[model samples]
Structure formats: C-alpha cells, structure tokens
Target chain A: MQYTSPIREPLVLQGKTYADVTEDICRQVEAAPNPRWLGAMFLSLLALGWGSYTLYRTWWYGIGEWGLNKTVGWAWDITNFVWWVGIGHAGTLISAILLLFRQKWRTSINRAAEAMTIFAVLCAGSFILMHMGRPWLAHWALPLPNTYGSLWVNFNSPLVWDVFAISTYLTVSIVFWYMGLIPDLATIRERAKNPIARFIYGAMSFAWNGSAKTWARYEMVALVLAGLSTPLVLSVHTIVSFDFATSVIPGWHTTIFPPYFVAGAIFSGFAMVLTLMLITRHVYKLQAYITLEHIESMNKIILLTGSIVGIAYLTEFFIAWYSGVEYESYCFINRAFGPYWWAYWSMMTCNVISPQFFWFRSMRRNIYVTFALSIVVNIGMWFERFVIIVTSLHRDYVPSSWTMFWPTYVDVGDYIFSFGFFFTCFFLFAKFLPVINIAEVKAILKSSSAPSVIEKEEKVKAGVKLTPSYNPKSE
Target chain B: MTKHEETHKFLVGIFNDEDILIGAIKKLQAAGVKLHDAYTPYPVHHLDEYLGFKRSRLSKAAFLFGATGAILAATFQSYVMGIDWPMIIGGKDFIAPPSFVPVTFEFAVLCASLGMVATFLVSNGLLPWKKAVMFDPRSTDDKFVLAINLADNKKIEEAKIVELLKANGAEEVNTKEIKKK
Candidate 1:
C-alpha cells in the first residue's frame, strides 16, 4: 500500500485483480491477429524481404557494393551499427537500473523494453555481419584456436572487446528477459485451450509449480541478475565507445567519448522505447496499464539524458579548440561549417534542441508531440554518428586523399533492411509473449488508486446507481 | 525437503489473499502440522520468514562462478598474447594486463550470468523438459495455496485438517497424492 511517487495515477486502471491482469495479458497472446497486427506484420515482412534481397546483392558483390572512396570507409554501416546499439541501451537500463533503484514504475514497460534491447542488438549484429562481406568468417572474431600458425584474436583490439561486449550483452539480455517471462508463460500454459500452444508454453514454463521456495529463488535470481546487468550495461556502451575512442582519428580519439556515448545511447534509447510503447499501448488498448504517468516519467529521463548529450556535444567542441592541435581544431571547425554542416546541424537540432520541449509537462503528456519528437531524436542520433564518422574521415590533413562518401542504392537498402529486421522480430515477439509484466503489475494493485476509480467505472458499466466519485477536472 | 522419489499425501488449503495464507500457515504451524509448501502467483513479501526458511546461498555461488570466469579469461588471454603470438603494438608490452581488462571483464560477467541461471535451474529442478507435480493450476495464476503433507503425521485425521483449514479462512480445501520425481 506504499505509493512512492506523488502522482496517484494508477499504472493499472480498472480495479483489476490478479486474475484480471493475467486474463488481459494472456488474451493478447491467445486472441486471433487483429487487422492492425496483420498490417504491421505485412510491413515488417516487406522490409525483411527488401533486406534479404539487399544482403544477397552485397554478398554477391563485395565491399565495393557501397560508394566508399579512399576516405569515408564507414558511413552508413557504422552509423547504423552505433545507432542500433545505442537504441539497445534503454531496455537494460529500464530493467536493471530501475530495479536497483526500487523504481516501481519500470514494472509496466520493462518486459517490452528488454525485448527491444535483444532485437536492437540483433540488428546491430546483422550490420557487423554485413560490414564483413564474408560473414561466414564471423566466427574468426572469437578466440578459438585457429589452425593457421596458431594465431589468436588480438585481445588488445577494441574490435575484440566489441565482439565480447555485444555477444555477452545479447546473451544476458535474452536470459534476463526469458527468466522474467517464466511465471507468465506458466499462466499462459494453464489457460491455453489450444493443444499446440499448451504444449509449447508448458515446456517453456519449466514446470513452474509456483511453490514458495521457487518464488523466493526466482526473486533472488532476478535481483542478482539485475545487480549484474547494471554494471554490465554501463560496460557494454563504454566498450562500444572504445571502438571510436581507441581510434587515432581526430574526432574519434577523445576521453569524453565513453560517457558522451552512454548518455546519447540512453537518450536515443528512451525515445525508441517511447515510440514503440505508444504504438503498443494504442494497438493493444492498454491505456490503463501503460498510462500517461509512465510516459511522462520516461520523458523526464529523455530530457535529462538529452541535456547531458547536449553538454557533451559542446564539451567535445570546447576540448577540440582547447587541445591546440590543428588537426583536432579543424575537425571540429569542419564539422560545423564544412560540406556536411547540414548533418551536424540536423543532429544538433533533433537531439539537443528537440528534447528541451519535454521540460514542459504538457508536452510530455501530449502523445502526438512525444511520438513525433521520439522519431526526431532517433533521426538526430543517427545523424550525430554520421557527422562524426563521415565528416571526420572525409577531410584529412592530406587534401589530395580527401573525398566525399555517398551511399549507393545498396547502402540505403541495407539500412532499410535493418529496420525490417528489427520490426519483424518485434512483431513476432508481440504476437507470442505477454507484452507487459503481469506478476509485477498484480503486486502493485493494492497501492495503486487506479482500481478504486476503475471499479467505479465498472459499476457504471454494470448499470449500478453509484455516483462516480472520480473526477478528471478536480485533478 | 522430501527426496525426489518419495510419494506423499498432501492436504492443500487455498486462499485468494496473501494475508489469509500467511495467517493460515502460522496457525497450522502452531497446531504442530508440518507444512509441506505454499504456492503463490507472486513472491509474497516476508513469506520466507513466516515459513522459517534459512537465507539462500545463491550469492556465494555467484561469487564462485564469477571468480572462475575471471581467472579463465585472464589465463586464456595471457597464454595467447604473452606466449603464443607475441607482437609489439602501440609500443606496449605484449603481456599488458590493462589492455586485456575489458574483454576479460566481459567474459567474467557472461560466464557468471549463465552459470548462476544454470545453478538456479538445477537446484530447483526447473531445467528444461523437467516435470513436477502440480496440485492446482490456480496457484500459478491467482490463488495462494498452502500444502500440508499428511504422511508426516499418521495420527492426523484428514477431516481434522480440513476443519482447521476451513476455520482459518481457506477458500477451498482439497487432498491429493503427489509423486515427486
């Protein structure tokens, strides 16, 4: 019965009991695919098809499929890789960081966010495969003893750290997401009338009998995993940043890259979560479960991280000038006023400026505005990576070697394909799994004032004579 | 805890509320009935203390696994860089531990996480494809159920236990024979 936040807006509206929560979630999985679900699936499949064709072309040809000259080796490929990786951060942060902080609000959205993280990492992994034309040799990145002269992976290389960081991140995220789903999967198993579904969910449930010892152990494991994931999340992005920071390139080699990239990752990540959650809430008719409070809280975080990213942007410029290195100073100067000034400015406008609107409570509450800004923030973040990679690499100290990097049809198609991959996986996830954490929502039913108000509404539906005490205008 | 092979007769008292379940457990324990287990949809806070279970040893296991992962990663890295294919890069020593730290740390976390989950599953007999008896399906959904092993006390009559459960606010009472594997 302890409500931590002053905002009494119930996370679960409709005086929902434990049974109601389970029924609502299980119905989403069990019900026939609605038109909206079908429409989304169609779109995702189209993207997947496009991506498959593009991959074939890239593999059939070579790295020369992209419009890469002497300069700008990594334009869209690394940009998409970093963008997807950044988008993956929000899920782990919501699940692990919020759990450690005892923020109960995370319970509603953590399941979907964790799923997003796994999917985003997969998208990032795909880019890595595509970036290496011969993805069959992808296993060479591992430290397996090779037959050729007993050569091993260079542990000192940041790329090696990347392989470990990304693979480990994906594994832990999957395990964490699956662990949280066990109880709910058991609920689905028991309720499922369909034999095939019953069989699949039954086996997946691991025969969870809901015994007291099992619940205790479940909580312990969740806590330990959360503890492990918190530091692991920080390290994943920090290691990712090392891919740039370890480089000798003028814009890439900076100590500020780690914290800067982490903040940017989180900022963009929350935006992506909001974008997806808004659609999910609307599509699934889960307004009571998702609520404006959850959305507003996420916005506040976006504002905070966005501002941090802004400060980092400014700090990077200041340091470049302060460093007194002609190359570094020119890199910063050329970024703002050079040929790719439009990309740099677009990043500044979308990532740094747009998130400032969230300071107003009304803006955060406005769904349309939130959704629009979420897309804008993602666009800005992608451009930020593009500006850093393309601009920095395009113009070097040796002017004769400098060239413009323009992505060909294959590059554009591949980027679109990753979106197709991300959404395709997401559509499948939404179709099968309980999008919300049912058990955690049930735990909060008592403390939330939502059910009392919701119960009154239900009475109204039942044609009771009770006067509705809930007032929207009073609040 | 009974062995996996043992067969036991159980009297299950089901309640909808956690408070009622906790109160029932206390009363049953006071009456000298050895409680077998309680099943709940979620982890009811303080239920472990009420059941008189000791603290879990999961943290100790995590520490052991984590240390093992760290040692393995560091040793693997050292053997590769220091002995197998020694080469000078960035003008630093080939066996530089600092440079190997990130991957080593990642490998440690990866191993520890997977190991902890494996340990939990094995300990709880919840590994994939494992089967255990379910007294009532409602326990995984909405109900709080307290199970008492009738085989623990031969003198305890079934009707007496049912009457006790009814008196203590049990919504439903049932008896079942469970075969553990």
Candidate 2:
C-alpha cells in the first residue's frame, strides 16, 4: 500500500490569512450595491404581504379556499409540502453528510447550503402548519396531556413522525451550523475595533485561545455530530416518505418509497443549492472561493440524483403496469396525461431530460448552463409532487369521486407567502453569519514539517541540498 | 547571576520547526519551569495539556444557565397561557401538551444558546473595551509564541527556559513586563 506523497508544489501559494480574508469579506459586503436592501424590501413587501394575505384568508375562510374537497382531500398543499421538504434535503446532504465523508470540496459551499437547509425547512413547515386550515390549534397532533376534545395524539401516526422528523432535523442542523461557526467567530473576534464589535466577537469566541487541545476536541465533536447527522438526515426524509408510504393510497403505497422520496429530496435540494449559490457568488464577489470547479462537482451530483429520481418515477409506472392493477395504472397514467398533465411533463422534461446535459464534462462545468438546469430541476421537482398528489387523488377508484383540484386564490397566495417567510430568514442569515465558514477554508490549506518522498525528490532535482542533512537513524 | 536574576529579563530564541519547539517545551516542563502562555496562528494539538491547562467549565455553566432559562420559560408559559387565560381550542384540555411543545422546546434551545453565550463572555472576562497586547501580529498567521509572565518574580531562570523552548519546538520566545502607561 505504499504510495508517494505529493511534492510540496505549493498548494494555494500566497494564501491569505483568515483574518485578512474575513475583513475583506466584511468590507465587500459593506460596500456591495444597495441591491440587497432593495431586493429584501421588494421581495418581502410583495411576496411576504401577499403570503400573509393568503394565510389570513385561509385562516378566516377554512379549507374551502384551497382546491381540496372530498374527492381530492389532499391537493396542492400536500404537493407543495412534499416538494419543499425534498428541496430542503440537499442542504443537509452537502453540509452534514459530506462533512462525515471528509470531502474537502464541501467546505467552500456547505455554509450557505446548511443555512438554506434551515430556511427551506422553515418554509416547508409553514406550508404544513398553514395547511391545517385551523392553524391556531395545530398542536393537537402532539402527545400533550389534554384531558378534553381528542387530546390523545397518536404517537404511532406518520403525521406524528413528520413532526418529530422535521423538528429534530431542523434542531440538529442549526446546532451543527452554529458549532461550525465558532472558529470563524473567533477569527471575527480578533479583528474587532469598536467596543460593540469587540464585545460581540469576544463573547462568541467562548475564550477560544485556539489551543491545540481545544482544536482537537472541536474537530472530534464536529466529526461525531456529523456522523450522527448523516444517518439522521437520511432517516428524516425517509420518515417523511413514510407519511405517504404508510398511507393506504393505491399509488403511494409502493415499497420503493423511502429511497424514491430520498432521491427526489436530494435532487431538489441540490437544485436549490445551485440556485442560492449562483446569486450568492455574484453578490459576495467570491470568485476565488466559489469557483467553477465547485459548481461542476455539484452539477455532477444533481445529474446523478436526478437520474435516480427519474428511475424511481419510471419504476413506479412499470410496477403499476406490471401488476395489472387498474386503479394504480390509472393513477400512473393520469399523472402523465391528466388534468395536471402539463405539470407532469414539465417535471419529466426538466428533471429527467435536463440533467442529461451534465453527462458531458463541458456542459457540467458551464456555470450559466448548470444554473439554468438547476432552476429547471427545482421547477420539475415541484411538479413531481403536484403530479403525484393531484393526479392520484383527482381520479381515484370511484368514478363519482373523480374531480379536479384547482387552487383558489388563497392556496396560491399561501404558496407565495411561504417564499416570503423563506427569503426573509435567508436575507438575515446572509447579513450576520459568514456565508462561507472562514476557519474551515484555512484548515484545508495546511502543511507538515516532515517532507514526503516526492518533496525530497523534487528538492533533490532542484539541487536544493538540505542544510545540516542527517540520515534517518533507522533508514 | 544575582544581577541577571534581579533584571526583568527574557530569553528569546527563534526556530521554524514545530518539533524542536515542542521538544523544548517538554524539556522545560520536565525541568519544572512553568509555561505562562503560548500562542499560534492556528491550533496545535496538545498545547493546552502541555501547558497544564484545565478543561473549560463553560459547559457546566451553560447547563446551569440553560436550566434557569427553561424554568423561567415554563413558568411564564404556564402562568400566561396555561392557567391565567386558559384558551382552549377544538375541545382541547386546559393543560394540553402538544400546544406547549413549541414554546417549551423554544425555551430550552433559547436558554442553552443564550446561556452559553453569556457564560462564554463572563467566564473569559471579555469586556468590550480593552487594549491588550497586539504584540506580534504574526501570532495570527504562520508564527508561534511562548510568553512567560514575570508578574510575581524577576525572570532569573529565563535562559534555561528559553534554551529548552528553543531545543523542543519554539520558533520564538518573548516576554512582557507590565509598565505604567
């Protein structure tokens, strides 16, 4: 198993000190165009206000405002929920799971992805909470001791599972995100000049002297948490899948659900990572950090997962047709050519066909091309949930039960409102926290005193004699 | 020797190798000289234990602060929403558990985060306004330092300590004497 160590070819020669880099980052943010402020105002005022209006009407008018009725008891709301939840998955995958694998490339982008994870989850949860036409008393689903009016919440319920799954995932991700920030906080602490800056940074540094011992512990703890999160992340979305798999719906009850849902989630999530990153790179002026190499790597993942999800979609169809189950076949066919047929094909073309471009190295590396593809991936994923929910529910077994689900203004409004909630949180995170983990980036560029064979050989080739050279006693 | 002992002195040596610096520190520790403090641009493994530092008690304080926060949050919730107003929905019981989960969970997390933050500040004695040493900016990048405070006594044995630090791994050794500004 002997191998040569790479010669000290000067990895990232003339590396910037973390402090300088951080200050530069802060200055860049400070000096950036007022577009962020203006963007925030515009997105919030229009989207947030509209969303609030939709929510207000939903609360006042009840479930009637949505396209849901007896036939399609669950319509666009559930579709939106599943879609957003999948979209949230990419963040955890990039941050927690990738960290566990020790993928060095993830360091550059994980911060933003993790932040997006938190915000995306918030948005997803809002859709669900609002879906509860009675948004006020949404707690009846918890195992609280309520001695009156159906107080006993069934812990066994998948709905209960959803509550635990989403909440725990969110909590762990936030903690992981914050823990990762500590060293960067220390970096910021050192640069503080104003009293307020010093106070704030010093407080957050937690007496971190950057001692070797503390660093060891920090790395160990972070690794352990990453380990915990990797499986927890996989399980969280799988459990979310259980919310559907456990249901008695003909098309939804397939054995291939957990993996299918998980794949879809990652597919959507990576798309989201790309979307947010494209905007962030331009705004932050981080050409060096968020390089094309990174986008290409991510695009590869999107392609891999996109194909996986496409296969899942196809597998479901094959299974239905193979089993000769009329109801299931009808559901599958209706999805591709039903009232929501447009949404279905859109999902297929964008998600399945679009990522096919990444099979080429050139296309994958093209940032603009990937950015466009990632957006299409998101739209397709959104339609995936729509096709799954609307098509299946619209034309169930009973002919009289067949109906169309057209979202009222309230339903559409709530959709927009959730985006408002999402963007506002994101805008704030971008402002405060280092969007890229400053400390981690520095750790990646490291050197050791002991020269490897190649470095020694290179030095020898360069006729650079070692001063006071002494042979190794054993050698 | 007495004249040198009486002088506020420091032995400074510079080495580029970490192993030599570490070996020197170990030799000094073995010889029973106290290491006051050390600094590096980035963390070095085992530096704290080598210097005989204790584990941070920040976690314990955070737990205590978090407990206090949880209690207060619960009390406030019970008093205001549980008992005082008792707003029941969907024939829900007055003491519904589900309704309290969000608030209670929020309180626990909020408390833990805030407690850790405050304890982190207070334990470190990190006041906002202080002009401490900016002695060597290199301490923040690609340089290592060992500082022995001469607050209690004149640095008589500094030569031996400096020699050992240089032998073990120290790139540079320096000292500071508190002077009236």
Off by over 4 Å in 2: A1-19, A28-37, A149-151, A447-475, B1-156, B159-181
DockQ of 1: 0.71
TM-scores for every predicted model = 0.96, 0.76
Best by TM-score: 1
The most accurate candidate by DockQ is 1
TM-score of chain B of each: 0.91, 0.79
Give model 2's TM-score versus the native structure: 0.76
Cα lDDT listed for each candidate: 0.88, 0.68
Interface RMSD of each: 1.3, 7.2
**lDDT tens digits, residue span B5-95, model 1:** 7777889899977878889888977887778889888778778878887777887787788889999999989999999899888888999
